[model samples]
Target: MGALKFKFLFAFVLVFIVAIGSANIAEFDEVWQQRAAMAEKDAEAAYDPYPEQSRNRAVEGRNSTRRSLRGYKGACVATNPIDRCWRCRRDWARNRKRLADCVLGFGRKTTGGKYGRYYVVTDPSDNDMLNPKPGTLRHAVIQPEPLWIIFKGPMVIKLNEELIMTSHKTIDGRGAQVHITGGAGFTLQFVSNIIIHGIYIHDIQQGSGGLIRDSVDHYGFRTMSDGDGISLFGATNVWLDHLSMRNCHDGLIDAIQGSTAITISNCHFTKHNEVMLFGASDSYPKDSIMQITVAFNHFGQGLVQRMPRCRYGFVHVVNNDYTHWLMYAIGGSQHPTIISQGNRFIAPHNLFAKEVTKRDYAPMSVWKNWLWRSENDLMMNGAFFVKSGDPKRMAEFTAKDVITAKPGSYVPRLTRFSGALHCTINKPC
Candidate 1:
């Protein structure tokens, strides 16, 4: 046999072996089929948050409301149509639940407080974390059944401990100034179907975690928390929107330990060391099934690292305006699949941290097969993304057909309303 023919045969055998390995890898196209199976089992659940006529229009079942937010009560034309969809109406404060219809992303399946009656919070106190008082934020969060919680007035609450939230709840802060600050923050653990919107959460301190009330009927001992603005542990189907968060002791948001079907949209995060973290660690195999959508947010001002550091999951970061960063931006480990689409990243003037990506806990020799990709991303002012992953496998991602993200230049328009919004009555917000 010719030497060239022998080399060709050897290459073919190597390709076959690697193809088999791709079948078992966590950060690849195979996980899309896994998510589809989960969706099939929960088919009875309805996407009824949207009007029947406008269901499942685009990627991630997003049916965007293309309503123009201009010309209502002399309101200026808005850039983000999603933020304008509900608040543009004259009767916004009256029909507050309509904000549920405005959500557009992967966690859009969340129907939080959709089936519950409204509960108004008149008190601003968090006197006790273990024994909550009625009419307080703590009391509302500890309720067992579904609730649409709203604030009656402007108030700043300093929590004594973690505000442990129950399942099937919505803490909607429309028409009021609500701030959860100066102390420990939220702990969302082992729950599902929750929505947190239009609030300011910042300046968090770590908790000496002990017995905390999660629900009216359930109170359990908790270990010390890491002081994240929002900590999601083993949670699913959660949505966070229109929040202004900064200066937390740990990450601004940490979704770990099998948290799936989550979305973080239109939130402003600033002045933090570690920013967002997805999946817990590479050792947790269950986290391989996690999937999250992060879209239409602003990673602005005083961020050190980890725009999101992932481990064993599929995370889509799309259409975000990143105006500042002290260190590198996106990162991953444990072969997590990251699809960065249409984000504007402006690196700090520092030369050492100009790269926008980092792969932790793995060397290139072993991590090259991980499926990390960047599409239509705008890196400006010397910013760059060091991409790694299987290019062929990334192209085959099934979620690509469900939701097509806009380009990075559109980040400015998408993240126009990137924090807690104060919508004036009879005015488009």
Candidate 2:
């Protein structure tokens, strides 16, 4: 009887152990399932196909308002001839007052606290093109003051001539719209610490009169010879956010002459030849360092020839979605340290398609421009290129050799979200 009791007890213990093991397995499965579901939701949010019609409508309304104001001055003169005579006598006085009001805000620095520490300069009449005053406001918001320039209505700045922007400014659009309707070849040069946010910048083409000679006799050629938009030369620490740029000849954003620490974020770029460019002429080797960060942007239809050229500096391109690109989306000099990672690139044909191939530009580099693609990336283009060397044998090389070795160090480890893990072997999902 005692032997029989022992056998029965052992059977009960074995069954108990099996039950506990099953429970643990079930818990592990549940946890994995929850993680998978969350990942799917996040991807869906990032790649939502819905068009932003409302945002586009808001931009259009502002553009229309600026066009109406441009022709308003002539109408005022024609409608009131008698009043015009009186206005002409006090024309200089009225002009000075109007100019001061438009540029200097009626002798007051702040706009009655409606805007933050920033100032607003929306009137085209407030052009300080010939001689930009030390503290006068222009299309840019002067910084350290944190001013907001509400283009309260749609407006344009027709550059009768060139304009010079000084340093330390922030141009915060309080949701007011602005347009640049003027000579395409006119340039706004020499600016720093500028923040151009929430504005629709488009449709200004190149003009006649071509390149204008500066006071120093250095010909200031327009970016596209006659195109109109913001161009940064020797500028640093600038932030351009929530901007919709399109239809310019050169590029939406161009950084030349070692423009460093610039951030272009949350912008929609389209309908342009070369949406973004860095490095103008490689003649000045010292001026090649253009450290730029481009993140959270959407690049859609009508984008081609986008990227920096030879001898540029560090560029961090992350968290952006590219819908369609006509040619090689990114191609340039081998010297620039480019970090292309964590982005969703969707192209109908071969992605990362390129015309030329070359060796890595520099030696002794670290995460200098490492690429790290998260498992969560919905789409991945062509196979990432690396130097022909066994990565696992890296320990044999000296530190200097390791740094100089052309082999790419980082390998993307993708974590699949669902039962579709088998489908993601060819591409990350």
Candidate 3:
């Protein structure tokens, strides 16, 4: 009789577990569909049909000699629409808050600290992890109120531990040369509306875990960091722009565990393997909501692979200059939708690594149906992109071609000022 009871209980528990699993799968599917729709909408909204037409018309009116005499410095040259929005202004310092309104792509809604007062970082020291000084960058980011953080001068801050950030903050390193190196990197975990711009983040090391203040009201024990230059764990509405990154212990930038609505733009990356990873785990179906836009960045020398590698997400890689790569440029697994539009891919001299895209843990029969498209991409040095999926599906994913881009041949001119700019007080950035 006892044996019979045990068998009946086992059957009941199995049914209950199956029911819960089915319900969770249904929830995951629902969230994925919603986020995918939102991503498509954001991508479409960020498109500009003709950014260079006006400039080209003006150049045509002027003679070559006159144009040459004008020079590159006198003219405020803004290539892409994102740069044109703010980089053309001479009084950018006077109106520093205007940059908060200029974010494009999936992170367009990120108005980081736009409504808040400026918090200038006068100190570059990170002596205290739990109780940071008032004039330090750590203090500026952990405040409960919004703040537009900026540096007073050129400085290098080697953090003693992982610098945790709060919501509604902007670290604008426009006028000053700011470098965060030889230590741990920034951590944006479960935060939103953050903009990290114009900072050099490289040579990072893993942090030994201890008590760290993450916010104004929260101080908690933490674990050792992965040593990424910028690590995003469950973060949203974040934009990283005009930064130079390389030679980190782990990835240059990593967004994982349900992080979404991010844009990495106008940055320069070099001398790094596993440059960027969008989704970390294949089993994390919650990452289906992850969406990112990589635009106008220069992938320079001594790079290996994953610029970036994605999984279970939508990534729009548009108008970037890939000058060098030892391994494959872009890679993925678990059926991520990657739209490569008008990007310049110059493969290395190595004949074995000529393919721009790499797929893992999937056979041709399965991965051939994944939505990966290359539209107007310029491939050089015998480089090629192995595209898959149906044309109709590609059209649908692109929202009827609302997200248009310039041809990849224009990449050099578009990405001319890719990295952090040296802006004078009253000059255009």
- On lDDT, the candidate that comes out on top is 3
Model 2 ranges off by over 4 Å: 1-117, 125-128, 131-148, 160-163, 181-190, 207-228, 308-310, 350-429
Stretches of model 1 off by over 4 angstroms after superposition: 1-78, 398-402
TM-score of each: 0.82, 0.51, 0.83
lDDT of 3 at 71: 32
| Model 2 residue-pair collision total | 11
- RMSD in Å for model 2: 27.8
- lDDT for each of the candidates? 0.75, 0.41, 0.80
**CA displacement after TM-score superposition, residue 8 of candidate 3 (Å):** 29
Q: Write the per-residue lDDT of candidate 1 for residues 18-75, one digit (tens) a residue.
A: 5433112122233334433454333223221222123233322122222221233544
Clashing pairs in 1: 59-402, 59-403, 370-389
lDDT of 3 at 189: 71
How much is the lDDT of residue 165 in candidate 3?
85
By descending lDDT, how would the candidates be arranged? 3, 1, 2
Q: How are the candidates ranked when ordered by TM-score, highest leading?
A: 3, 1, 2
- Writing each residue's lDDT as its tens digit, candidate 3 over 354-384 gives 9999999999999999989999898889999
Model 3 ranges with Cα > 4 A deviation: 1-74, 398-403
lDDT of 2 by residue, 1-429 (tens): 999999999998667645433111112234334433553343233221221122210000000101111122221221111112222232432221221111110011212222244344635554343333433334343233434444434556555433334344444432345555444422323333455555566765554332433322123332224253566655555666556677764566776655555666556666877667676654545444455666546666687756333245655554455555666555445355454544455554654453211232444363234332122233434433232223343223221101111111111111001000011111211
* lDDT value, candidate 2, whole model: 0.41
